[model samples]
Target: MKKLLYAIAVSATIITGCGKDDEPTPTKVPVEGEITGDITANRTLAFGNYTLKGMVKIQSGVTLTIEAGSTITADKSNGEDGLVVLNGGKLIANGTSDNPIVLTEKSKVAGSWAGIIMYGDAPIVNSATAPAPQVATSEDGLSLTYGGSNAAHNGGSLKFVRIEYAGQVITTNNKEHNGFSFYSVGSGTVLENLVSYKGNDDGFEFYGGTVSGKNLISYGNSDDSFDWQDGWRGQENTNWFAYQTGIGNYGVEVETKGVNNAFWPKVTNITLKRAAGTVTEAQSEIQLDAFQFKANGNGEFSNVVIDGYINQTTPTAFTGGAVQIRDLVTYDNQVLTGKIKITNVKLNNTPTVFIT
Candidate 1:
């Protein structure tokens, strides 16, 4: 398996309401404020139950460390509540399985909030120079630039985190924020044990990044569960996708954007579970392709199990060598997988994103 375990070395300290320290970390400072400049000091946000009200930014050359067991809710009334880690900025959000961190909207509705974005300067295809090392900036209004020769660029650490009711819509098209958007991040970045549930857009989307991920879960996302574009070359492992809603799009959506065709990511031990029914016949179950690859995208899938989806039509644009699609498993003729079996763990009255 292509388990990129070396990407993140996370701490195993779980903190609920009780802390191991004598004096518990003080609470009250909400994630509500503007950061127009650099933050030189190390700040610990006591997730004492507060809501993030607007677009919070971590300026370049700054690190924001989040305390474990903290649940940061998004007040998405204005549709702009989320976190953005700009290039050269870092976010260390390390949460334990028992006391995992949660980011979701107060409304608790999909498409009601924006999500986390990590931008970095790493190597991408057609990168402005010959043999191409193309650099790119974020969408309008973000002003975040990414892509460079630094394969060791460290964006930050995110472990045992859950993002729910996310994926802000930028337009009517598929242009929107993902549950966890990794833009031009490098191999030195850390991503693991992340769950994205009921997102409006894709669950975990990568654009021009080389970061590896593990223990990912995406359920009931409106768009793709996992998506990548713009020359992403990462490795992912132990991902579980449970799409019981017909609104879900692709299990894995691959695309190569701009003038770059270097889309290759190693995916291993994937399990896409859905109800057994004819495609488009079930309103509350999966009804589309489990995997969709286009625009010269490539990936290597090993030990994959796609359950319950009756028909899988590969796009004509997707060809061989671009991706090694192997170990395919589908529905068992007439046997239904029954309802999704998920482990629900609630935190501090916060809605828990269901995990397997």
Candidate 2:
């Protein structure tokens, strides 16, 4: 068990009132019957509470649709509770803004379970366990093999939901799981208004996928708020605050793999903020490059408002190399003729490179 927190002390702060002290959480009466193994048909998780005790793989020919205001709890005693949507599987989890569906842990602690994994047949370059096309299950220490020719493949719908306390490092090889791991998921899916909190790993991560998203929020999480890799053409529509609690690591950490391929994602209408805390707390404890874009990732970050950062230049704003450093005027096809509208930030050190 490779816990990322080795005495990582963090003050318990509420983000969206999910596990906050001011919110009234619903009690979960653990479902007795097992919802494990491969789901066979169209199963609708109606207004009720359920528990998943083991590995659940939604077989290809089925649609697992979860209704609004539904709460699904998990008990990770032996680290088995995980939801995997296969290549051809479809999920329709449509929760509203007021009554969003919530998937939480029984203990309500961070690093509870493996996490939700969405797999598809997208395109990729090279993989350690996968041979470009015919990828093996040994790649990510699990059975979610990703990559294909279809760029518009639809895995399912994960909208208006709160995924809390997932991303448990199950095994030594299984430490990379996030709250929502989109592995080769395509664009024909629906991922909107998704929120992840208090997870031990990244709130959301994309591994060689082309799926876009909207209205994503993460708070108090132990890792990056958003992470993407493997030539992803992510087109996020809109976003809220990129808040950081005492346990949060980064706001956005994007990597282009060792290939350093020139790939970009369109991120629009967002505000990045680091919550105020002690000098040695979350916001101030950011690394040399907190919001680093590794492997020369090119993307359009337009209409971004940054606030509440102690020293903007200490942990450099955007740090990464690029094969072709486009002009600051043009990014991800949007023409940004002005600055990123940085306000409320206390800049001490002279700034280095930004948006290249």
Candidate 3:
């Protein structure tokens, strides 16, 4: 009987040891460090805190996947800091509403760092009658050219990503970067639920891209809240909201690099609001309009809501309007020709419809 009891006790001890061995290991926390250099292979950044030290480029044929709840602080004090997804590369940053991916600067001030820039091989129209699609050089000081014939090109996916205090000046001639600059990104790319907050320049600028943006928010940007150039023709853009504060120029500044094309961008369900004390970039009477169309910029915009775009100039030097045509050439060619279609616009606290 004693021998039998000893065998049973040993078996029970062995069973307990096996159970302990089956337990899962705890996930390790990542140490904080600066992220730089060109990513040549597939890499995944798990949930952690990181700093962007310099020009971090996700090179071609590589995929950089960032997990949700990651916080990347831009170390602007070090040097020119920015993230660039080159053409043929991918940046999959998919975050949830509960825990969004945040890229911000430590200074918490505008123009603190260069912002996120992505390049894709998307079709763009630069000449009025070019037989082939034309590409343009990037003005973000990256010294790169972008544009191609891949209308379905896919740069990557971005959701619930917030960029703060970006739009740093990168050129020696005083050209600043936007908060989110899309350079010829194609239709297969996914951009949604993104926020550009308190940038020194435009909140979101598309440079000849076919990728559409959905549920985008631009708040407190100094320049235009939404700006596009180089014949951007995104057809599925919707639900864009902009709130200009402190200093601002226009709610929407549209341009096509002085080219009037048959095809233009289409956007719906937009909201632009300005605080009462908002001032223009010039601090003068030149750029206080809600919507300014120039350089043959034409689009199909509908269901827009404009509010609080009051002219804050001293003694009210000029009359502000909900729509300001910068040149008579754009008015004659685009607006009169029905290329610039703006319908179902609702105004609240707006001074005029067209600035005379």
Best by lDDT: 3
Off by over 4 Å in 3: 1-31, 313-316
Instruction: Show the lowest summed lDDT stretch of 10 residues, model 1.
Output: 327-336
lDDT of each: 0.63, 0.64, 0.86
Clashing pairs in model 2? 122-148
Candidate 3: clashing residue pairs, number: 0
Q: Give each model a TM-score.
A: 0.71, 0.74, 0.90
Per-prediction CA RMSD (Å): 11.0, 9.3, 12.0
Candidate 2, residue 137: how far the Cα is off, in Å? 5.8
lDDT (C-alpha) at residue 293 in model 1:
49
Ten-residue stretch with the least lDDT total in model 2: 1-10
Considering TM-score, where higher is better, how would the candidates rank from best to worst?
Answer: 3, 2, 1
Better of 2 and 3 by lDDT: 3
For residue 198, model 1's alpha carbon misses the true position, in angstroms, by 0.5
Clash pairs, candidate 3, are none
Candidate 1's C-alpha runs over 4 A off are 1-41, 126-131, 140-143, 171-174, 236-244, 258-263, 276-287, 311-356
User: Which tens-of-lDDT digit does each residue in 78-147 have in candidate 1?
Assistant: 5577788888889998887666777878888888767888888777763324464677767524656667
